[model samples]
Target: MRAARPRRRFLGLTATMVSAALSAILAFTVGTAAPAAAATRTVNDIGPVVSSLELNKGYEISRDCGFTGVPQANVIGVLWLFCDTAVSPTGQRVWGTTAGTAQAFTAPSQSLFGDFTDASGNNVVQFIPNPSGFSCGGTLAAWASGIASIPTSSPNPLLIIPYVVMCLNGTNTRPLALRIVDYDYTTNTFSNDSPVGGTGIFTGNPLADNRILGSPVVYNGSLYFYTGLCTSSAFGDCSAGTAQVAKVTLGSTPFAAYNASNQSGGHRWLDPRNYTFSTLAATSGGFTPITPASFDVHRYPAFSGSPFVAIEQDDIGGNITVFSSSSPTGPFTPRFTAAVPCNSTTGDGGLCRAYIGHPESSTSSKLMLSYFQPSDSHGNGHVRTAWIPWS
Candidate 1:
């Protein structure tokens, strides 16, 4: 049976609405200590609580790379933030305006995952690149070793962000790969470390069409990844196709590291064989429309009430909807939908996409939602961070 959830009438994100939302979440919630009773903050810039934890002032350093969850690299008390850059890797020096510029990528380095200090104390970045015209990507072990080779002596090394690779080269063969890149906090330049973690291709046929939908978001301590599988030569084996979810704990030391060290040995994860997928089932026949990719997953602790366990995703119509569930791979119940609070004075109107959440910026009262607004035709836009009540 599904647990009773407290649903809120989310009109818009503001100081006033946030207050009411928190009340609703806590009212029907029963669990650990409730979030703080009060939540009031000044809504600034293009909108309330602009994105990237208020680091960028509506000016995008790189489009769609604004999700800066909990500061990772620390040098002299400075948190070096990590996010993706179309042609290069980007970093932001927290508490200051000293910015790091992006360089070109050999294969146009694509979506990057969260930042973490690695075991060696070096600030390492993990990214999933959409392979373009490029040579054979290197080995997964080499990639892991290269990033691990960075010479730095920090404290905690947090690597990997539950990102699935997609090389998509029908003919080319590369052992399941994910590129591990290193970002120099002091220099701000992104360098391709060693082995390239390329795409994972299962269907040998070109028309097979295997895909991982939406986006990968970390909830609680596990990574919620959804994938769709379809094959042709096998005929009706998977006719209707099967949707499966892979739940990887964040501490798996990134896919590259796991592929390198435990490809055949160590057992750091609970998944059978270090990799067994669970299928997501539908209990009912007809279901409400759902978001393709859940942009943000609030890292609400298990005890922090029921409503707080939510996945925030955006519809194609540009609406940001909230859903609640007991499990990360879930049968989510739609709580409410709200128009993205995006505002702009330049170009066409403002449209927000990529509703990412920053756990470090969240409190008991609110979840920090980061997104890109007023983007160009190519989906390039400045970053905006907003605080939404999620008690």
Candidate 2:
């Protein structure tokens, strides 16, 4: 295990402040404001495009572990990561500090990708609630499997995690219904406490817009999330040609106690089916975002006045682009864009997709960005990261 980095204290905005932020975001995304203008894009040359020596060297076996859509969180200073999995059809979870040198995969597989990704190591979430009390490891759901914990801030004793579930035997209709699963941290094993609300796994054609992408951003009591085009399914194209951002207003909608349960009073998370939302491009940016973009935001302290940075990939998946906003809500003007090349001759020429950022490692000026190569041919779902500088 590596030494943990000193943790940063996350400042939660008060009700009044959050309201003001939302209003500001609304002003730019909708109403009477003119659309944000696009900035002229330049070639990638801000700094050195370096590979994540630690992570790529740590995981990614054939047909497994190294796929894209990498989501992360900083729990108690240790960086927890969950990537797309296929080898055993289980969650690809790992954790470490500074670098991902810790053992993370649950089973050992042959490293056919010719990378030092894994050989079976310690793969539980770094922060095990209470081994003597609750079982964090167990059957996540019956017939349906739950992905790793979605990123969100917990304000109460009960940690509310939004889980993306997949139904087995071709029964999954709505794969995007993020379930607010409760881990029995105070129990002897995980009770799989799924709160009653909008809905869960059921058979039928999955709603085109049912699935929400990426870890959610919680601000001012409401849970902020976005729906994207479904890339991996046999059902109808549930993805919109273009999906905008939306929030699940905790005060109303969904159900009663929505606010209080999610860390309101100090709790948070949303039904994800309905709420108020807007777009990242209307405020600014040269391009409009689309599906599998993995829209995400981060709060950086050194960003002068604006503390938030919006992350997504270019429409063609050629560069990892960003926009800076005052808050989680936006008026997000273009901040930076970098070209991370993809081999056109190899594995579907992924060219890069699912560009995301690491809130735990990014700085005001120097940003930590990552993306994955499609799981085609020899590439077999490899993930790479780089440090991009702000201009």
TM-score of each: 0.46, 0.52
Model 1: residues >4 Å from true position, as ranges? 1-62, 71-133, 136-154, 162-223, 226-244, 249-257, 260-288, 301-303, 306-312, 343-351, 375-380
Runs of candidate 2 exceeding 4 Å displacement: 1-76, 86-160, 168-176, 182-204, 210-213, 228-243, 248-293, 344-351, 374-378
**Tens-digit lDDT track for model 1 on 333-371?**
555455565543234223344555444445565555555
Q: Write the per-residue lDDT of candidate 2 for residues 22-57, one digit (tens) a residue.
A: 211121231222122334344322221122331344
Top TM-score hit: 2
Go through the candidates in order and give each one's C-alpha lDDT.
0.31, 0.33
Q: What does each candidate score in C-alpha RMSD?
A: 15.2, 12.0
